[model samples]
Target: MARTTTPLTNTQVKQSKPTDKRQKLSDGGGLQLWISPNGSKSWMLDYIHPITKKRLSMSFGIYPAVSLADARKKRAEAKELIANGIDPKEHREDQSRLQELTNSHTLQTVASDWFEIKKSKVAETTSKSLWRNFDKHLFPKLGHRPIDKFNPKRSSALKLSFDIGI
Candidate 1:
């Protein structure tokens, strides 16, 4: 028979004190609060990786900052991802990288990089004129937008220019 664990309460969590050895307080469902000998407390979840069939531990965050309720919520979400055969850690990392890329690759930033290469291959005066045209006409309208958000069909300036053969 499998042993059952009693769910932890907020009062019990708050009353827990650090000991000479590291202590883990279980809240059931693999959610635990670890109290280090140094008196730092943090939330952790132990789960078996769906693919590797190996046990893995994932940290949620520190105590007080991450309340008992919040830690439980994150545990539920992590379990849900595992049920879908996705590694929560990898998903989190991919999300962070995507956000960084999205923030860095705005339309003006990409255009500036393209212009730098164009400058090396074209005449200085030709490059200057072309850049000036874009700086004045395009940058003001859509330069702040991310590259992924740009739509040629939605841009009136691009549509008008294209329609008139510019």
Candidate 2:
């Protein structure tokens, strides 16, 4: 494999003692820095389950493939989720769901599409009346207003009651 950016010197690997515990390379938290016999440094993080006390580790990917800063960020997120009694994997799923929902749409886009679909079924006279009423009354009052609003927008001269507000 190509060399990673984890900062291990070939000579330094020969001088270090080995222990069962994972070693921290820098003062930075959660980065378990290890020097191999061939002088390659690898990083890992261990997380223990609170209820079961079982230890598990998830890679943030290899050093150069996943930079130190990004690995630390991943670690922090994992820790926060764990602290909240949430599984990091589940938290990741939730984040993905939020992103998908956020990417989907605006109310206006959906409403306009529905309007187009419904418009095709109407008679010309009815359509004309709809357009006239809509443009002169409905469109002016409601078109540019917040799409989230269910209540009709009221101009000063005409006030109409609504079942709900936006």
Candidate 3:
């Protein structure tokens, strides 16, 4: 197979040293390793926004942590997204937001966190009553649900429970 000129070799990447000014080493297909003045290196892709037709960059990860091969793979994936008319930067942001949403504390998680905090500040009897109230009233209906989805105005269950004094 004929050797490509653009993709950088491991030796070339390993030999790269940072200078006073930052340097960018192209590994072909828009994958590049940016060497900072402090010798820290990170992988990024330089691409054009699919919709806006503007130049943009997105970081993959740090060098060593994100090797040249890994960077190339990331670049290929970005290229695929671009070909599909999706900007990689925006796609990345959307993925990040989705991850954040999924990982955010649910009602149960927030209640537990609040309980821990309050336990440290309040009397033991008050803490026990709070826990009893949560276990009886909140956890059965809303604990598993994310806090964002809980609308007080729309919850008939809450109104019923309040009327019954449970």
Q: How much is the lDDT of residue 59 in candidate 3?
A: 97
Screening candidate 3 with a backbone cut-off below 3 angstroms (N, C-alpha, C), the clashing residue pairs are none
53-159, model 2: which lDDT tens digit per residue?
Answer: 67765555655566556667787888887888877755677988976665444334544565577568877776566556556765555555444444335443123
Candidate 2 at residue 126, lDDT?
Answer: 68
TM-score of each: 0.71, 0.41, 0.64
Model 3 TM-score is 0.64
> Candidate 3, residues 1-166: lDDT per residue as tens digits?
7345577898988899999999998877778889999999999888899999998889999989988888888889999999999988888899989878865767788778867987988789978987898899888988788777767678875566557643
Once superposed on the true structure, which residue ranges of model 3 sit more than 4 Å away at CA? Answer: 1-5, 105-166
> Positional deviation of 13 in candidate 2, in angstroms?
12
Which candidate has the top score in TM-score? Answer: 1
User: Looking at model 3, which ten-residue stretch has the lowest summed lDDT?
Assistant: 157-166
lDDT for each candidate structure: 0.88, 0.56, 0.84
Candidate 3: residue 15 lDDT (0-100): 93
Question: Residue 149: error of model 2 in Å?
Answer: 16
Instruction: Give the distance in Å from residue 127's predicted Cα in candidate 2 to where it truly belongs.
Output: 9.6
What overall lDDT, based on C-alpha atoms, would model 1 receive against the true structure?
A: 0.88
Q: Put down candidate 1 lDDT per residue, 114-163, tens digits, no spaces.
A: 88887998888988987888889889987888888867798786676469
